[model samples]
Target: MNEFQPITVSRRSSREEREIALMQIYRQVLERVPYSYERKAMAKAERDFLSDKIGVRRFLKELGHSRVYLDSFYYSSANLKFLELCFKHFMGRAPLNRDEIRDYCDILMKQGVHHVITAILDSEEYRKVFGCFTVPYARQTKYYESPKAYLESDILNHEHVAQRGRAVPTLYWHQLGLNCEGGVCITIEGENPALQNYHPEMKEAEAPQGTRIQQELLELLHGLDAVEAQRLVASLHRKQDRA
Candidate 1:
């Protein structure tokens, strides 16, 4: 196995960007750890078996036996901001791997949890810049699958509308933009507005529910001690905000 490498980030990036990279790195380390899939599956099956063998009320009580499994899957989450920042510094991007992408499904099987990853990777916010890499859904859309689908009318014009409504907020990726001693600069352009608008409707028609969950998630990131909250907020897309 390849030994882990250290990354030297540019001094010019903003404090926020640095923080995000750090948080993402923390997430990357967590991703490398192993979880017990067989144990969880066996336990779940046992619960069901017991439920079938016993009465409903008895099974209900037994179900509480797996509270740890439920908590880790449904409630527990690792902080990825440090991991994101580390990737930004070393590779200048986020790591896109099967283990990284599919771990959530391994941990949990709920519909809502599945949608969170889909929205971030599939949304225009991601597609606009890095372009789409994987389509997790059965019904893939053209915009997500093809960058050419983004017409001038869709993003530019819609940006005007979003700006008018104060709905779409601009994000600066400059290394030193938000929190830095000064001197470094880098900017990233994201998905156009028109296509971005369609993202929410196509996925859920409500908003990015993942972000709301993230607000609580931020509180749970315990291991990383040196990072700040603003940095993670910057990396996150404002899915819940109204347009």
Candidate 2:
């Protein structure tokens, strides 16, 4: 009787390796890049490019040309803001100081946005720390001790904050029947006659529609258990009957 031996193979074909590399690049670009809009379209485009075997530098350049990038970062934002975006998207770090900002801004002004992006990706610093396979992460420095502090700093000014605030289309404040500032003045004129009485502590005109007793009962029963709620209701009913 011959003994059966198990064989183990640990190797991937060139095509398989290339596919894996492309998928990795896609993930890194998608995850690291900060596109404000058209995320789904951008992801699809990256996948398509991977299928076509487009190199990383070209992939990054293509991402930079995206509508979201063009509208938000490239065309709209200032040179300094663009440099900051490049740092966040490529190196996963905030610019340490004014000099660093100036140096990048100089590059952007001289070579252009695409060249600046390519330079960052091809930098010896980036290559040494995060190779092609590894995803770049934020390199924490002493300038901003923590993420909270970093966000609070002048680096993230109100202009940047306001730029990110997109107007929600489906959110109709007018449909809520609110005034211009989302406030409504309650008046007794069109309200139910039974609800005209004001709370004792409140100003007569500013009082709620419902009586104090009804308000108290509602507050009491708001989060009660079944037994407790029933008991409270029965007690209130008894008190009403006695009155």
Candidate 3:
């Protein structure tokens, strides 16, 4: 991936340039896996991105849910291990702390894997790092809090199944100094800003009326089909006149 270099696509970019962007985009998302020719699952997504009908973010969502990714990473790996891989591929890091892992694990258990994939791609951190049109790459420059993020990246971004198995997080081992030959390991922690407080399911009873409405709205729009989503959004506009 050339130090996870960025080959961004713009509306003004030439066809050949966008094509190159497509190649690198796949490399960045799928890692060292085969992202061309054999990937019939991603054919429509490929066409949309090439024609500028979809941005890199949307393309990434497709790639994240593709059967290749599910077979290679999701279904094969446990929830924690899968979360670590998603962080490396989409967000360019590992679990910052136990809470971060727990939060995603919560979402994974409650909402299913596809939502977890979309949550990472839809994060504010993701928007800040790669935005809509730019490709996501495992680059350290985007992460400055700790240099170990790169090390964690290396651990989580592998094509081989994580040696830690599906249940344990890579960060836990890194904390215990199992990932390296070190005397001690300090904590590497960050908040759960990515998933918009996806932890602790704030369903009907738990959340107050206003928060409950927001939660319900979010749920409604999340995984809906196109026509249904459009209709619901229109109804929301007609109904929710608040800021």
Q: Please, what is the TM-score per model?
A: 0.19, 0.42, 0.64
lDDT of 1 by residue, 93-169 (tens): 33233233234323233444334434443446445533421111111233432342232113222231112122111
lDDT of each: 0.30, 0.45, 0.61
Candidate 3 pairs with clashing backbones = none
Task: Give the Cα error of residue 45 in candidate 2, in Å.
Answer: 6.0
Which residue ranges in model 1 land beyond 4 Å of their true spot? 1-30, 36-74, 77-111, 128-243
On TM-score, the stronger of 1 and 3 is 3
Candidate 2 whole-model C-alpha lDDT, 0 to 1? 0.45
Q: Show how many residue pairs clash in every candidate, following the order shown.
A: 27, 0, 0
| lDDT at 98, model 1 | 22
Could you say which candidate leads in TM-score? 3
Question: Which tens-of-lDDT digit does each residue in 153-203 have in candidate 3?
Answer: 666655344444443345644443232122222223422121123322655
Question: What's the best-to-worst order under TM-score?
Answer: 3, 2, 1
Cα deviation at 72, candidate 3, in Å, is 1.1
